[model samples]
Target: MKAMSKWNKSVALLTALILVLGVFAAGCGGNEESDAIKIGVNYELSGNVATYGTSCKNGIMLAFEEINKNDGVLGKQIEGVVQDNKSQNREARNVAEKLVSEGVVAVIGPATTGNVQAEEPVLTKAKIPLLATAATAPEVTYDEKTKKVRDYVFRVCIIDPDQSQVMANYIFDELKLKTGSILVDKGNDYSVGLGKTFKEYFTAKGGKIVAEEGFVDTDTAFKPQLTSISSKKPDFIYIPAYYNQVGLIIKQARELGVNLPIMGADGWDSPKLVDLATADSLNKCYFTNHYSVEDPAERIQNFVKAYQEKYDSTPDAFAALGYDAGYLMAEAIKQAGSPDPEKIQQAIADIKGFEGVTGKLSYDEKHNPIKEVSIIEMANGKQKLIKKMLPEH
Candidate 1:
């Protein structure tokens, strides 16, 4: 009886030992699964450009959520750490540094050109891939002679030179505005880039720029500048800046009896434009943008439906570009078969003929996309689609 009891006790001890080892191995494996690949997001969440930044951030998050739902990149879950720059240059640089320190394989944004310019060099030094979703300044990816990008910088949107030429053609040929005044936002890189290009091509198209003026982004009263522009008796006014200042400029321009056709760049795609400008004041205003919500593409319609269901409103160009940027990154990672920064960068450079909700996307050698643009007009306090142009190149 004693021998049998001792044998039973030994068997019980062995069973307990096996159970402990099994649990230990399982715990380690579960932890490994939980620690997944990381991506970083930097944007202007708390300043003047907060609206565009937040919209882009939401689009990226939505895309990442969808990608993770279908198993994830390289069989591992993906995670994102988002940072806000508050639209300050110093904060933009700090945000980029923080994202790099978090060990993300890639970082997206600082959506505006000013913020991207501030952050690009820091990201380049870290050797992490940085994709700017809406920075359209020509200088973002080029030098004068070579037009080559710095090692770590890239942009997913069309550059200012392309947009400027498109706007110039639309205004001179389509609208037939021969003489105009230029009012630019002096503080923004986007504004400066677009303003310079428009001036160059408008003159080339035989349109005279009668008066040129500038305002800081934070300025609310354009009465003084508008007064001068109106005195010039121009046929139109070109405000190459975001909607916030554009609205104020329009409202003030009309109050001072400077009612001419107003034209602008993609920065004007916001509900705030209509909110600030009156029905009569906005009738002749127009701007160029990425994609139109009115477009009949199935992919665009599906994205619109999803966005409406989520945000309870229509999605703008900022959101569309953000969604496209996320899709591009994911596609490149998939094509590269790994998240190695060098491989992914090369694969992104080689991306051609990618169909996105925005439009058919192809990257240029300088890391800008070759895509079509839409011209939008405001009527009755709503956006009306005017025309779409395929890039002539």
Candidate 2:
């Protein structure tokens, strides 16, 4: 009886030991964490700027799909935890908090400067890196007043000054358009800042700003400003605003018989630009962009082909930058040799010559991509790559 009782106790002990070991194994695995690395994709997915967000999301999805189909980073798949900012500041902050809660290693996008800035406090406090895909404002990665780089912030696009100054260089030195007019949106920092930079650079290069007109973002009627600009007879008009208003402005300017080359920044890269302005009206329109589908380089062409095959549309500068953001994160993860966020952040800061569809770039001290700008000219609804120029400085 005593021997039989001892055997029963031993069996119960063995069973309990196995159950505890199984629980430990499951805890260590933790489902998705063991199988994939998570990166947050917070962007303006469904809002006034839906075009930019959708394009960016499409590009990010393509990059991760390609990475996973082959060999994923560190033998684990990358999962993008996408959240829409809805083109609102409050929504952006909410998305940032949600991404942090999801335990993402890094976050990408909030494409515009204001939305990007809105999430800064949340992400910075959470110790998660925020990489803006298309936020071109100078303050996105650094504080203007403090004049210091934000430790947890980075970007894959050039800031406003770079694109603005580069376009100014092309206008004054290359295109030889010695006089320019500025039509700026008073409410938008991006538009207003671009005008300031372009004016500064162009005037410094011996060009004159013959007329400057201001309009609020909501104004659809731009004839008054257009008329004022036309009266000055400037060589070109720079409408430093987004596609929504810029499109109407272009159409109105054309109808008003203001026939001159109109220029803008990356905000003009949306497909809807042609639709809003009409193809014919955009003939002499140009904008400084991150990438042009018209680029003939093998790398650029290959990306364009793949994107077209997948999305059934031409990839814009936003898409290119988002695609680069995905690969940039992957590269940093690989270089860090660990999924630890701190190591990954350091690796990203040290990156140089990182190949992107837009341009081969390295992170500058300020974490902006050091890359050339592609000047895109619109002709009858078709985009043509006129020239690629490096920043003057």
Candidate 3:
């Protein structure tokens, strides 16, 4: 055998280097497979809707703690990568992009529909699944432009149509209210969606919309709108907005002698609503929520007790939704038998009926949660569960 030339030696050295690098990469991939599963938590930790985000974040944390304590899912711990989006649409998109870059298999999205929508494109392009905490607008799961379901997006909360129809039905058929007014934040997608659906369902049932007013989210005064609505003598008024604005609107409406029963969707679930609207002003005010602490179900009762014990406060609907999302994600991972995002998505889509603190959650074709709407009445600075309405579907 003859000795190899310098050029051949250089080629052999290069080939050996490539083989070594390949082995190193393969080892790293194997190590990662055995490590903790990464789940991203993108929330509005500080912004206009901080209350919702904070409550939801707490619930997610608690669920993870319980899961980790039990040795996590699929024999690997869950590593929740939490980030604050400041409740801004652009920031939400940025956070999602960051989570994707970090190699998260799935993400818990912001509590509001607009924020969730902002994050959807980023996650979808990355092929990562997102479980939205409370984004209930129908478009969150079903993309209007595509005329198809958003494959990467899922929400654990009842959609606007479901909650709005529940409230509309409660007022028209159950409460026997024939006419009502609507006040909505024109800029907020959530408010607009709920308002539109409530009107559609109420009118279809032979109920009349006596008045409708659109307000900007920054507006402080609702008396002008309330006065116009009061003059119409509507049996009830629907205000689809956040807790702060809804609270002030209720307080001002009551002060203006608009004694009509004021109803809203889940946006009215914050504890600060009592402080903002005043307990007396909340009389006859009701809202459709995800869950109520007053529920008698064993799961709800257990969650309420655990939440109060852990956080020293009762868990709201947002919290319940977040907690359910965490467990749901774990269940998906367990069912998938792998941390692959596509498998996780399929596992979640395959969920038939999942029982949680909120209710039995199944997904509609739109990937929207199929759960009962809890009508909560606000009275004397406390929330009371008035009724639970099952969806027609």
List TM-score per model, in order: 0.81, 0.86, 0.85
Off by over 4 Å in 3: 1-34
Computed on alpha carbons, the lDDT of every model, listed in order, comes to 0.83, 0.88, 0.88
lDDT of 2 by residue, 16-67 (tens): 9998996686456557365789899998989898878888888888899889
Q: Residue 50: error of model 2 in Å?
A: 3.1
Q: What is the lDDT of residue 107 in candidate 1?
A: 86
lDDT against true structure, model 2: 0.88
Quantify how close model 1 is to the true structure by its C-alpha RMSD in Å.
11.3
Clashing pairs in 1: none
- The clash count for each model shown is 0, 0, 0
lDDT of 3: 0.88
Write candidate 3's Cα lDDT for 335-364 as tens digits: 999999999999999987898888888887
Query: What's the lDDT for residue 279 in model 2?
Result: 96
Query: What does the lDDT come to for candidate 1?
Result: 0.83
Per-candidate Cα RMSD to the true structure, in Å, reads 11.3, 10.5, 9.9
Evaluate model 2: give its TM-score: 0.86
Q: Please tell me which predicted candidate would have the highest TM-score against the true structure.
A: 2
